[model samples]
Target: MPGRVQGKVAVITGGASGIGRATGFLFGEHGAIVVIADIDKEAAIETAKEINSLGALAIGVGLDVTKESDIKDVFESAAKEFGTISILVNSAGLNPRLPSLAGKTSEEIWDKVIDVNLKGTYLACKNVVDIMAKGGGGSIINLSSIMGMVGYNSVMSNGLSPYNPSKAGVLLLTKNLAVALAPKNIRVNCLNPGFVETPFTETLTSDAELYDNLVKLHPIGRFARPEEIAYCALFLASDESSFVTGAPLLVDGGYTAQ
Candidate 1:
């Protein structure tokens, strides 16, 4: 039996950890040639090695999606290596919760978050359009969040969090690109996930009080698993979603239903 994405090449940014890493593994398992591009070179390589060991074709590359050269190089090289890139998962992103941004000022935090979360997505989408179009069309899955659709509660942040704004930008960007690139045969969509249990949320989840509060917001009584979200990405990447485009598929555990 052929896997859903058999023989297709999927280039995933932020493929070293969290949702990105899980998606890479799922894509590989389903027979796609995965390219794990991330800021952590070694982690990315390790991920690719693991996928290959599982009998999938994959390669890992260090990437800083904020840089156009990095995006160009990774996408082009992946196309060159795999013959063509038919799928792209712009999963690279930043949130105020990142420990690296701990001591940074508000301005610095805002800039960094927006750069990686929004601009990086823009750059990756811009660079991959040509390759996907040339390949006769492909699916692009951007990772947005429930925050992208609605404002966060005051308890989360005095409303100064750049995370929400950056993700909100991603939702609109997905829509714009979907409209502009439809004729080119490329399908663009975004996944607005709710809280997911991944390293990315370790900091907050480690605090029992905060974790409980956050979990209650979901209405499902818990956060999502990384693989659950990856399953959604799989559908978008596969031909089963041929008629889906310019959509924001919410896999947010009824968080937005309230």
Candidate 2:
């Protein structure tokens, strides 16, 4: 009757709102000592409070995915307070309007998107892996999107690209880390979600036609709830996936089936 992640210490990047917040809450629900790390300090504290309300240990840290100092401080504190980092959710990423292969998007847009989505993920994984390795073994889950697995659309009318390739990069990063960390018993994986109704996509929710179209696109006939994606992440980060690594688990509600 033990919870799947009992006694585990998990640090989630971008754990203020959207999927990150939901995952933090659920991870605690399942017995993880949750650390909600985010750039938005106020929101992170609020999220930490919510987790504590659930009778689980929780803390919030001000962190920026682009900053090594922040990652170091958080990991050090987490290691000291919550014990070793047994779970990591690299959910910190951005969705900037980018350009296409040609002269489509602006240089600034592409840089920001790649910096936050790819570089950000790299930093978190790089910092956490050492902690996990020292802890013996752990699970690392990176967030990718359906756009990464396939070209969903043109990121820009002029040629800007946004999420497609960045997510694709995440997909591969997950696999690479899995292989590299396998010798140490650490598991690395990715979660690819399609059109989930979370704060990250709340702006799009107002467009009825767009929302309806998104629903129709999924074979399941609905966008996923944040908790649904959290469930998939939970499985990957827990012993439930003891034999799973270097795998990209699709929580797209069958959007890729088409």
Candidate 3:
């Protein structure tokens, strides 16, 4: 029997590490041609090599999602190499801590976060939609966050955290794109996950007390693994979610439930 998403082509942004890397591996395991696109060229290349060593077809491209030229170039190359794009995973994002924001002004912090988290998603979608449509429709998975649905805990962040608004924007963008592309058979959706064990959260998770406090926020009392989130993306990317679109699937370890 064929694997889910067999023969589909998936391009995952931020695929050098974390959830994006995990998702790329999962997609490859399920027989999809995977493109690992990230700003970290060396890491992306290494990831693609690892996937290929496992008998999967995968490639790495240096992609700065915040750059339109880079996004266009990556997608175009993927299309040329793998045929019309079929799946897109917009997983590139940022969540700088207070110290990282220290030197930067509020406006700068907001711009950096919004540019990478929100504008990047929009640009990736904008570039890939035409390819997906031409391929008779496909799946586009955007990564939102539980914070998008609810404000972060006061201990975790201030009320004005740009990460929250950026993710919230992604949630809305997913819905809008889903509705607009339904007629063309393209499915647009997002995943709102709680804290996951990824490089992005290393700063917070490295501190035992902070990690414990963060885990306590989840009703499940633990953080998510990258694979757990990847499986969710696999479901959305496959035909299993044919009827699912414009939906924000929460895989939050019951974080939002509390």
Candidate 4:
């Protein structure tokens, strides 16, 4: 049997690690030519190499998602290299540096969090939708969080800053873009993940007790591995989800079921 995404071209931001890296590997294994884009140039290259080891085509790109020109260039290069892009996965974002709401939150930090988390998604969609549209249609997967679903007790010493709001913004962005691009045959969707054990989340949940407590918050009493989230992204990025759009598919281990 052929792969689900055979011959497709996919651009994945934050592709150096965590969900992005995991998704890159899976996409490549299933036959999509992958473009690994990240701010960390070396890691991006390494990830591309790792994906290439799976016997699929790939390239690593250093990019600042906040820069429109950089984003445009990524899509342009992918189009030139692969003919046209059919998939885009926006997975680049970060939490504010750990600080109490009083000690860590600042105008600069707020802007950084929102700029990368929200604005990055906005730009990726703006830039890649056209590429997909030109190809008749395509799929877009926005990385949101369970944080966007409701207020949670954020342990960031400086507090939530713009991370929470930016995620919430992505939820709406997914919806609006889904509606706007539906006529063009493009599909837009989001994944709202609960706490997953990744290098990025380790800073917050490395504590055994705290991590366990976090787990208990979920009906499943465990955290999702990065691959779990990546699988959700894969489904969204594939034709299997051709009818799905404007939906924030929650993979929270029942964190929001309460």
Local distance difference test scores for all models: 0.94, 0.86, 0.94, 0.88
Better of 2 and 3 by TM-score: 3
Best by TM-score: 1
TM-score of each: 0.99, 0.93, 0.97, 0.94
Q: Any idea how many clashes model 3 has?
A: 0
Per-residue lDDT tens digits for candidate 2, residues 180-255, read: 9999889999999988887677656777877777788899999899899899999998998999999988888888
Per-residue lDDT of model 4, residues 1-258, tens digit only:
677888899999999988898999989988999999999989999999988887888899999899999999989989988888999999988776434223644787788889999999999999997788888889999999998887776543445457788999999999999999999999999999998877777765778777777888899988889999989988998899989999999999999989
TM-score for candidate 2 = 0.93
Question: How far in Å is the alpha carbon of 50 misplaced in model 3?
Answer: 0.3
Runs in model 1 deviating more than 4 A are none
236, model 2: CA deviation in Å?
Answer: 0.6
Candidate 1 structure quality by residue, lDDT tens digits, 1-258: 999999999999999998999999999999999999999999999999998999999899999999999999988888888888999999998888889899999999999999999999999999999999989999999999999999997778988899999999999999999999989989999999999998889998999999999999998889999999999999999999988898999998999999
On lDDT, the stronger of 2 and 3 is 3
Ranking by TM-score: 1, 3, 4, 2
Tens digit per residue, CA lDDT, model 3, 174-254: 999999999989999999999999988888899999999999988898999999999999999999999999999999999
Kindly report which residue stretches of model 2 are placed more than 4 angstroms away from their true locations once superposed.
97-105, 154-159
- After best superposition, candidate 1 residue 22: deviation in angstroms? 0.8
